[model samples]
Target: MVRRRFPVLLLHIFSMFAGTAGNTQEILYPFGPEHRDLETPKMDDGSSAEITLSISFVYFNIPYRTVYVNNNGVISFNVQVSQFTPEAFPLSDSRSFIAPLWADVHNGIRGDVYYRESTEPELLEKATQDVRKYFKNMPAFTATWVFITTWHQVTFYGGSQTTPVRFKCILLLNLA
Candidate 1:
């Protein structure tokens, strides 16, 4: 039995090393037909705009929110000012309107905070246009906008009119 086991072990060892020499070259240079050389493509002279906008309203009090993403990769937001009122007291005259909302954009590297508030309709439109322009010129892949909404005056009923609410708008661009 011992002699037979010794011969089997030697045969297995010899067979293992017998194929090692032939497989060495295959392991070193693995250039098979399936492996093809790939090259990076050059950038195009004219580029088209392809942008996606994701807007999330953190507070539930906000009723109407609109987000627009144009072909130039610009993003604009239009939130109804009157929707900030509490649902319980919708017809309350004492409720104060939204004064103006401020926005700041950060693109990982740099950040810019716009001090102007969107008090009037025209000003709000202009602010949206300005935000769109800012995003259009941004060369980064990802950007975030922080919107701070404040009320002009506290409501007499004392419901949800004291503190400021924040909304976030994220822009993701697909360069492919």
Candidate 2:
């Protein structure tokens, strides 16, 4: 019954030291969020107009997918109609002449869709065709018509993984 607790205490300390020596320490490098600084482009100081239309189609290849699509885009139509008319009216004239004028078409990317593997190209083709058809039926105009189509590829955290998607934007402008 003599003091025998000294040996037990020493053994506990030695075991803890041995355990720590064999374990490996890991070093972690944490990253902060990324920032993008962009400047706004100079826009024309004129009135803005917009026209929206709905497109519907049935794809036999992908019957289960959506059949109705809403195609929309921005319209920039800035032209002087009074100058081309027989009588040039003053700017103060409240009664403006309405005639077919020039139109500048600009297409913008709207939304993103993630599709299954090997289906992106087919889906994109189908969507593009449908958009073209919708615009072809628009009323004829006199000025140059620009059609802008935007496609975006977004990656999270700048990683290699990407979601396959297609977006079609159509802008139709008619002046009377």
Candidate 3:
């Protein structure tokens, strides 16, 4: 009886912990507007009318990994930023908004990157090479505004069998 109860207790605890994971949320920050035009115009009474026009642009980021499972059960790597939320971040400061930004990966404000590796000894080398090559020449990172943004839930897709995996969300700021 004692032995049987121990496994049941452990199972209950594991299930409870897993259930809490669904409570977390991921938020995406979209960019803001760009100041377009600002000029002083003549009023109907021949007085100077100040007309200040401001236009803003927002950019969003969507990153996803695509895996191609071959006949031998190898997962090919394809990591990329699916889309940029706001096309551009505009400001009147005469500075480039191309600077690096930060994001939360684990449902936090600071985003992180998701990385994983399998335990299969034969596949270990291939997985390492794939990840290294993927990171070697990644696309340019853009600033993602946290406010006035949208978010998409992260879900697992592809691969009928769920293998051991790890994930990370990285906050990338524009360096330039």
Candidate 4:
């Protein structure tokens, strides 16, 4: 009985891999709020005053769609947040001091991320269809992984106009 159970367990684990681990690609979106300064009460004795600074921060994961084809192919799809308008999207609610200070894209693609504040819904639909078509033409994909990156500010003091924020994304591909 013990020997039989061992083989069953091994088969279960191996079967799980059948759907994951294949060609994968990642897209990233970068945005952030500004830095701000805070004031603190002075500790009596007429010496020096204290100050506390803070900023707002936000972070969330994007959803992805995984399609399993009849011929052992898999395709993953998701919106590219990197294309959102820097000014509109990931917008901050406050002004006195910005959160984030600065935002950037790391990993996946180098350089700066692009945004489309005025991008139309029709454009988005077209983009999605394009991606779907691209994958459909490919021979087959065993599995895929999709990832999204975001930045948020929490607290700040002032004089932080040029701080660098870091974001990252990576994709792994596997052959069956």
Evaluate residue 100 in candidate 4 and report its C-alpha lDDT on the 0 to 100 scale: 24
**Tens digits of lDDT, candidate 2, 41-80:** 1122112222122221111222111111111111112222
lDDT of each: 0.24, 0.21, 0.21, 0.21
Name the lDDT value of residue 110 in candidate 4. Answer: 20
Q: Put down candidate 3 lDDT per residue, 6-67, tens digits, no spaces.
A: 00000001111244444232211111122121111111111112211121212233221232
Indicate the worst ten consecutive residues by lDDT in candidate 2: 5-14
> lDDT per residue, candidate 4, 13-59, as tens digits?
11113442332212222222221211111111111121111211111
Candidate topping TM-score? 2
In angstroms, give how far residue 21 of model 2 lies from its true place.
Answer: 54
Question: How many residue pairs collide in each prediction?
Answer: 0, 1, 39, 16
Supply candidate 1's per-residue lDDT for 171.
21
Worst 10 residues of 1 by lDDT: 4-13
List the pairs of residues colliding in candidate 2: 107-148
Give the backbone clash total of model 2. 1
Tell me which of candidates 1 and 2 scores higher on TM-score.
Answer: 2
Candidate 3: worst 10 consecutive residues by lDDT? 4-13
Prediction 1 TM-score vs. true:
0.15
After superposing candidate 3 on the true structure, give the runs of residues whose Cα lies further than 4 Å from its correct spot: 1-19, 27-166
**In model 4, what is the error at residue 60, expressed in angstroms?**
26
